[model samples]
Target: MPHDHQNDEPLSSSGHPFRADDDTKLSYWQVMEIAVRELLIEKGHISASQVHEQINRMDARSPANGATIVARAWTDPQFKAALLTNAGQTSRDMGFDIGPMQLIVVENTNSVHNVVVCTLCSCYPRNLLGLPPDWYKSRAYRSRTVVEPRKVLSEFGVEIAPDVQVRVHDSTADMRYLVLPAKPAEANGVSETLLANWVTRDSMIGVGLPRAPV
Candidate 1:
């Protein structure tokens, strides 16, 4: 006997199967965000176009932007000094939209290597480096990076010498960190653009070294 299975499958208005996005309901905060934005627009406190533009600007930021900053710091001593002194101001001066978040730039040297992690949550430098990687937000990374940083780093293929110290910095909601990996020797005379390409996100996170210029 043929079964009447038509009702078992859920379909959209146009007779297509519903997508995962359609099946899932909006989250509480998501609904609240929409309501707040709409209310602000209704009260003329903010314009929709302004909101759109801001979203676009945030979406445009990525690791490439941070890489460019790193490249500039590598080539220019003054810029490097300024960056090390005041990371947030230096980034804003360079036209990055880091908002009001406090950014700390740690430099990797011959004797010290710095790594950043958010044990409580994923407090990342997203405005400059885009979204944090999955591992960065994982429990293992958050907890292990603080406890056994050297072993965690080793798993990522970054082996620090016994004599060299590994320093771990915990990122908070108000403060974020960016690791300035020691510039590769091969990148000494490279152009800023080329240098930027060699500066990987993992390098900036202190999990790996900058790619050698080929």
Candidate 2:
């Protein structure tokens, strides 16, 4: 999707989010990336087939991978410890390469709530959770999550008690975070597969919780 380059107006005259700029205008990096890719293909340095394969690999990843890990952690104490200690290796053990980026798994407890955000950009644990949500990449979320996490989470319908402490984690290019949301009370006696189904993409991102099974 194309990003608008409007700087002055908060909202457009139509009362919608301002996107009055020309859609065809490309950012410097976007132009550079296209130029570089075309140059590489032109020189036969990399084949178009290789690029398509990489794109397919990325598209294959989804929240189910992260949810599987979370479900295991919820049921097995040892695995949970291993996940918290070395998230990268744990993910690799499950056949997911999290690349060189460090993955930090934060546990949401009864007294403490955890939320993750990348203030600079949309740095996320994409290897396990696929892509970051559009709202996560929004400037408002990146800025507001750190300042008023409780209120921000409340806006997402994730309410916490006044006594509960909210810890907001800032993800960077070198490191990313995944939230291990507290297992729902109703999830007791549920199979791991079913439990995995209960987890949502937003839950791993800490913007929401796992859905209760109907």
lDDT of each: 0.90, 0.87
Give each model's clash number: 0, 0
Q: All candidates: CA RMSD in angstroms?
A: 6.1, 6.5
Cα lDDT, model 1, residue 134: 98
Clashing pairs in 2: none
lDDT of 2 by residue, 141-189 (tens): 9999999998899999998899989899998668889999999998999
Where is model 2 more than 4 Å wrong at Cα? 1-28
Ten-residue stretch with the least lDDT total in model 2: 1-10
